[model samples]
Target: MRKSRIARSGARRPAVATGAAAVAAALLAGGFTAVPAQAATGTDDPAKALHLGPKEKLVPQGTITDADGTVHTRYERTYDGLPVIGGDLVVQQTRDGRVQDVDKATEAPIKVPTTKAKVTPPAARRSAESLAPSAAGGGSPIVQDQAPRKVIWAAGGKPVLAYETVIGGTQPGGAPSELHVVTDATTGRKLADWQAVETGEGNSMYSGRVKVGSVKIGGQWVLRDQDRGNMQVFNMRGGLDEDSAPAFRNAKDVWGNGKPTIAQTAAVDAEYGAAVAWDFYKKVLHRNGIKGNGKAPKLYVHYDNNQANAFWLDSCFCMHYGDGLDNKTPVTSIDIAAHEMTHGVTSATAKLRYTNSESGGLNEATSDILGTAVEFYAKNPKNPGNYLIGEQVNLLGNGQPLRYMDRPSRDAEANRAEGWPPSADYWKPGIGKEDMHFSSGIGNHFFYLLAEGSGKKTINGVHYDSPTYDHKPVTGIGRDAAVKIWYKALTEHMTSTTDYHGARAATLKAARDLYGTKSKQYKAVQRAWDGVNVN
Candidate 1:
């Protein structure tokens, strides 16, 4: 047997690189010449350059006539304006075969054009004055025959676009929400009018863009408005948002045979888990939820065959569960659901890319931390949950759990026996898969210290405590403060390459930022990290 991988393997695992960037660079490398920064000027043609400031009051030039009196030429700037910082000029311009005439000019800004330039074929006429500040740069441009669409508002200030969206209504089959709010990047606040199109044919429908920002409902990056958010042609594949396949779905009737259906059972588990996560984050840690968007969550269950795995596909904006064993067992157990969904939370914030050794482990550890916190939140009797993974699944018929945070290596295959030494592999980058499932023990151990308050304490009938790498009996910060510190650290401070040590520093910094630098929470995080040998 493959020694039973972590039941919630997908929870908080680091993201894997699919080599997409390299492929894009390769494709664009051929026959590509860099466009010069500046362009030349011509008669009847106004000088154009990328401006670093706000909109300029320039009455653009019209088409140029040829010898036969037929119009043979037209031109427009690539963009209305460029980025501005302080009072520095950073505009790029191109010139065609026209007479350079600064003296004979149309209505343009007071700034002088740059000396350098490039020339191109005649094109469309432009009347736009100055470009807005928010419309600057992003991914590389695709220079094709057809130009992309541009939406501009005339308020020297940028405009926000609102929309009439129908979300999950009072009734399951009722009209969805009629109003959705998304801000225009150009305009910093909410939109004045709804701009999104009405989309979707049924319950599995919505309209908008899946973006990385705060949502009214509170989940991070689930969805936002189409405007301002980068429109990636590739995002529709598993994207979530106000305009995505509903992330939350009833997992009933998942099994075709209708054997031992746990639809409602699983639904209750998922809801309860989500509720616990929300409460734990709010009441305890002061966090909202995955990315702290404070948005109502969306979930999905009963995914694929009798798959024995559950995961939070961040791109999909939903939690997926597997029907275990003979299809009677739904992996929608509270811990499993909480564990998987936490991955979304982690990704939206820390986004610790799953590749690399310790990064994967950190990802898994994040799920473990939040999962345990949720279980502790529920405090159910029959379900009597704790920090152990897969205890409810009975995946291990012998009553042995998939992982024991108190002492992870006891699971046999984890290879994380107590007192293991930290090495370079633990710090490598892009070692996603291996670090997630196996090396997660380190993070698990840190959580045990933070939650249970380390040093020879027995948790739920298991007598255990992890000693620091220095073989010292380490103390812990109470679970309450630990959860908050970890959350703040992940969301506000940590980056994709952060690891155990980085996590420790981030938690300490977050604690300091949230509470006072000398507050108990900050000290607790510092002590906790020190106990784990991260200080």
Candidate 2:
């Protein structure tokens, strides 16, 4: 069956007769959608077991229309040992009052604040350079504040105490977004103060502090940290599910002009990529895991109709992958997953801005760097790790990879040319039309030079070398040193407005700070810039 996009409308309430009991009765009555008597019982199909016990009732009623135009009236019930309320237990019913697919809904539960995990080797916090408007005495001041203490519950876990805050909001010019501040209460140290866009989906969409904080906006409250688990998987056009779960349907051809289906081949690549990312954080960065909270990583696939893009939506706390339209293919490859998830780690740590050219490029490059690293780490047979982007999605249909990190201009849209001022190259304003993901080529190329270690290098039969702006050989930096430098620059020193030139300078300084100015890593930072053609 085809899934339908849900439409939301303004809400109305009914008049109630009286006291607590009457209020409870009225609330429950208003909660669920009215289901026909026949639909309340079992149907011939086992999947249509849609009934709620009298004692199990919590809501008065509610209903959601599924993709197929079928009405699913959901009610409070006990399914799988978990309490089902509100939109949590939906049952599809036909006009004739017969139930359709009635399985325990897997839409995750709302997170409660609670945790025992201590903040691991804490990360350094860097102040954001004041937005121009704020400095000019225009918008709200974007200030860095410490996280506050509060209680929260981790998904599938008990409540725990944690720290959180709204670091900066509505810069002096009143920028449309706010920077959420999160940290470890026990240590009372800042962890991350990052930007977040409101989803407009009401408090329920976001699991924790945002909801509570919204209750008393102008006033302050201690925010409790809720652990958003790592590893989110979605049933896209083609996805796998347990035997008893409802298989996603109405598979369509989004990319490759072929029906989207989970091939064993693609599955192997995804699994390997996810595993490698998990390991990289554990081994290389010594991160407890994604989000530094030791939670399982999450993977979401098959998003949007004929959509050819992927992004990490900070509001949702998960990575999203999309099947390409006519011009692109499904981006459910392993490297893609690793790349998207790394954005989350960055958000939880550095919180890089997606706007402006340099930050935009860094956003894309971070994913690419880690994506390639994860690929190399996995060494999958179907998709051998390489410095290529979207190799498996086959968007080009000619079996060519998308975006060459060593030379981002390969895509035409990903113009990697530098030397232009930030506005000329960075702020095109449209979302990805010619924005962050595309202009990111410059930084991506820079990273490739930094990683592959300054020169023409070939892997798995693909050969390429770094080029300078004047079409000459740019030289500087070793791969190992470049990684260290960039990572330090990103997590320790760089800010949202930091541009490519700023990045070069910051990494140079970070190298000197981490290793003496005469060290190999220090020189590597300089060489990496030379190799990327950056003066």
Candidate 3:
């Protein structure tokens, strides 16, 4: 959910298709692998009942029961007792055990032998290092154990015996790197490699010097919340290296002076954002934390020199923020904080691929939706909840917000006439070329229409003019109900490869589960999708 610069063009490009093709090519070239598929006609446990092809065994990972009593079961695939790296799928079934849908990452069969590989572990390590020299740091690659597994070589090609090697080191750009290299075990030929690092970026006492949880350890007041599972915030002090950053401590619990001149100001903001986000999920959604396991993620503020972005790194299991615009504006606003952490939630739950168009767009939209929800939940007087994202941060430097959910097209800088990107009004073929941030407008616009309806309106002293692609007005379902439907769809209905159409179906199912099939909310969900032209 990293927001990059927007592409200002009306050209129609198939970025998603092209990116998917690139991913497939990477898989064949030994860069990344695909999961296996499971098709079950009977029983609730698809992992036990589904036919996963020769020598393959599916292990149930997790199960989510929808409001309507339907079950979505996730499974990990293995071949001949060896774990398959990318072989995972979800099976949907009704309360009576009737199978409704089977969402699989790959449908290929795995029939590879699990016998000891002909190639030595040293040789496999050398092969992986050769494939990713940047990960070796011009020295010996810290390769982990080589596990034998079955992986799909091509789109429909038969599964082959491969050695999955884990290489750990630092990349050339100084970022921590962990590469998963797949090599043909019999021939020692490299198949694919993928970076496991999930990069993301945050702010200050911008929430108006609010009370933060702190503890006095060794007579020093530390930014550690003992109440919230000892969650701690560290001050990077404009440093790029995270390992060396120190925690912000003060003589008294009071921190920040409403300005970035004081380092604790940003830490105060970050700590506050984390606290609110944690409470929002716990209280509003009944989820414990980002991973829903009652554990807190590391928070680091003032990362890098004048860094203008905030990111969440899976490798560190933490969130980092950069000071934007002369190192004064911190990106740690409540919505932005919630947005970045939501990426972590998405990673733990759906595990959606960030490169695929539809899934990637959905991924970004999910963050925006939940982040906005967090803002509404907080109701901070200094930073009141609104449809505008990063409004207080002034990321653009012109005082305009980073994005506007109520009117997504209004984000288009060049085409101010229509207030939207030229090709984003409808979900047609090839709209994927639009940046994930921009393509996200499609979903954002849909949510706005669903929650507030179409046309012009003003809320919280903010003006918004929204329009439908088909000129069909949608009835408002209110943000609270809409968010519940979305959360259900995201946590219970969505899979790894869900696209816009999949999202529409998932939301409809969520609505049916929550409000019944014939309820107004169910119909509103459909109308909202239609308004965005997702249907």
Candidate 1 off by > 4 Å: 1-259, 289-291, 413-434, 514-527
The alpha-carbon deviation from the true structure for residue 159 of candidate 2, after best TM-score superposition, in angstroms, is 39
lDDT of each: 0.41, 0.44, 0.68
Error of 2 at 506 (Å): 2.4
Q: Which model is ahead, 2 or 3, in terms of TM-score?
A: 3
TM-score of model number 3: 0.78
* lDDT pick, better of 1 and 2: 2
Q: Specify the poorest-scoring 10-residue window by lDDT in model 1.
A: 198-207
Q: What is the TM-score of each candidate against the true structure?
A: 0.50, 0.49, 0.78
Best by lDDT: 3
lDDT tens digits, residues 384-492, model 3?
A: 7888767765544466676778767666783354243532545777766555566777888888888999988888888888888899788899999999899878876
Question: Comparing 1 and 2 by TM-score, which wins?
Answer: 1
Off by over 4 Å in 2: 1-232, 236-272, 326-329, 413-434, 453-455, 470-478, 531-535
| Model 2, span 298-395: residue lDDT tens | 44445444545454545445443445554134455566667766776655434455543355556666777776777666555555667777655554
Candidate closer to the true structure by lDDT (higher is better), 1 or 3: 3
